[model samples]
Target: MPELAEPIVIVSDVHLSARSNWASKLDRIRGLWQKAGTVVFNGDTLNLGLANRKEMCRQAIECIGQICQADGVRAVVLAGNADSILDGPRHLLLKGGRLLVLHGDVLFDSISPWRRSAKKLRAARDESLRKMPPRMRASIEGQQASVTEAIRIVHDRSGKRIRSRRRTFLENLVSLSWPRQILSILRAWRDAPGLAVNFMETYSPQANCLVMGHIHRSGIWHIGDRSVISTEGFEGPRKPGVAYVEGDSVTLRIARQTGASYQPGKVIGRVAL
Candidate 1:
């Protein structure tokens, strides 16, 4: 029998928030956990910024550590928006060479969903007070709004703040119709530094693979001989979870449980790039 080499695996967006769907995928993670050459948390392992479920977030981090240590694979830990709540390293573990590990939220507008939600709710409440009975509205106005433009305005301000941090966020926004706040999300696989003026539209010509574990939209963008891939997640009922690849001959496989991990959880199955 031919000697079997360790398989390369990738995972990300393990949003351990109470609302996330990592239960089913984490149970199965042990199966793939035992085989890979490397395991990446890709970030957002905890709902660190969330208002509730501290215990759940803690469990998620512990579980990730357990899987990495048990498997004997080098674990790459990066920060997601959730992870940013604690304020430590932004990202860790790069690829083979000098590629830095990225949490992707650095490219984001805001790393704290809890904060963002709170502010929006506050703005909404204030706006609603403007319309309701002053007596009853006084209390509710302190919480959220009932109007549309108030929320929109608050969100718009958030985008401007996001652009201040990451140039990539602003640059990428030029391509989409999505809200500007999305631009602030720290990104995993940026446009490879100086590859192109348009990072999202650019691709590597000499690299084997450009790996990224954010966006949750799993698919590979190939340009010439280069390939860019977005890692799936364990947050929702999506396709093959987060993934990783090492070569061109390798093909990306979407597993039975690879949809929404939130940041970058490894619930994905990998064959080739």
Candidate 2:
């Protein structure tokens, strides 16, 4: 495969559904795409539970396809926890594996039991779908609907409660002293940064930086020589964020909604890998 070009844009947790005005949102970031050589949907771009998965994915692809075609940029889509049942790239490796870009769900595998269980369920669903006859499986709409319903059942069972608890735990931990917070992250639920560090040490020891989305909080943290970067969710009230990767440097940019369009805001954080 051809290598991705510089000034790559990594967007995560878009959570686009049938009701979302995602095309307009994409228009707001048109400049970024126009400048970018490659644009990556880091993950969770489609919220499978909220709409028919096939339709949602189709819309997302069409929207992104237009932007890439217009801007002469390459587009890559990665699957996140919400859409893990889908078939697509799950992560991207950059700069000879020095930078790892993923959805950040792997970090939560050990932090939340529900997430781990849900992954297993997703695997089972993928397997079942694989076993279906070619003709039956050819109708992506039916298969996606079934997968979405399965995900909804899993989310209803434990995912919602797990998220609430995780959020509360993170908030309380952040309120503590820096040292205490580190200790809490090590002892209890690993925050995004902690989890990133752990994931790197265990799976990709050579990776110096991890750019991920899923936590819905945009920030940068350093652990020794390694760094972890997170972007804000694209759907929520929190400022929508995106990460700009240029070689070994990464910068986080949030968008400010102005009437019907959005303009890039301040550089919230920067890190050098």
Candidate 3:
């Protein structure tokens, strides 16, 4: 493997497929990749459920290969929940194991049935789809479609419930006692960062910083000396963000839409490892 250089840019949850307008977004990413010494794709570079998996994977690989061939640029690609069907490294250790980069899906494996099902489908499809007879392939595809539809229904209901609860919580927050408000805030904090902390403790305790993307929301949370940085996805209305690493410092750079193109805009957050 080639050694990655300093000032590495980490992006995740691209979710590239034939249906999405990802080519222009990728071109923007390529511009950023050219300026950085290394580029790390944190995961979900392809959406297996929404496209012809084999062809999408091939196209993704070809595009990434071109990026890697850029002068003085190195690429590290890791698999996410959607693209786990492909063979590649699932996680990376950097800065002598002080910093870890991962897709963040592992944290939800036990709690998210949708994620678990998707992972299983990817594995089964990858292992058998090509070798199976046409009838078997049709059967598997039918099952996958059913499962995906069920997941979509459940996800929609869950999202609505979550939004309602968030609104109720905010409305009640103003009337609550200071102690109760503090507790509510703490509980909210515990939801995502708690999962990240538990995951790191179990899998990569030596890591003081983690760069991950699975949840679309982007933010940073500090757990003592360990910090978790989550980046926004390319598919969302929110500007796509990257974690720019330089020596012991990491800065979050979100893309700014210029007149005709996107460019690295501002440092929204930073952390020292």
Highest-scoring model, lDDT? 2
Model 2 regions lying over 4 Å from their true place? 50-52, 110-190
Positional deviation of residue 49's Cα in model 2 after best superposition, in angstroms: 3.5
Per-candidate TM equals 0.49, 0.70, 0.69
For candidate 1, what is the total of clashing residue pairs?
A: 39
Report lDDT (Cα) of residue 166, candidate 1: 62
- Lowest summed lDDT over 10 consecutive residues: which window, candidate 2? 109-118
Model 3 TM-score?
0.69
Locate the minimum summed-lDDT window of 10 residues in model 1. Answer: 196-205
Residue range 213-238, candidate 3, lDDT tens digits:
87776788898778888886767777
Please give, for residues 1-273, the per-residue lDDT of candidate 1 as tens digits.
121133545566766666655545565654555656766566666654441345655666666666666767655555554454333444432333222334443322222222435456455535655667765443212212232334345555765787778658677767463453355232323332223112223222223444555556565665654445565565555664545434423334564433422233333333233
Q: How many clashes (backbone N, Cα, C below 3 Å) per candidate?
A: 39, 0, 0
The candidate maximizing TM-score is 2
Instruction: Provide the overall lDDT of each model, using Cα atoms, as 2-decimal numbers.
Output: 0.47, 0.70, 0.67
Write candidate 2's Cα lDDT for 14-52 as tens digits.
Answer: 677667777776776665555788988887877766433
Q: What is candidate 1's TM-score against the reference?
A: 0.49
Cα lDDT, model 2, residue 63? 82
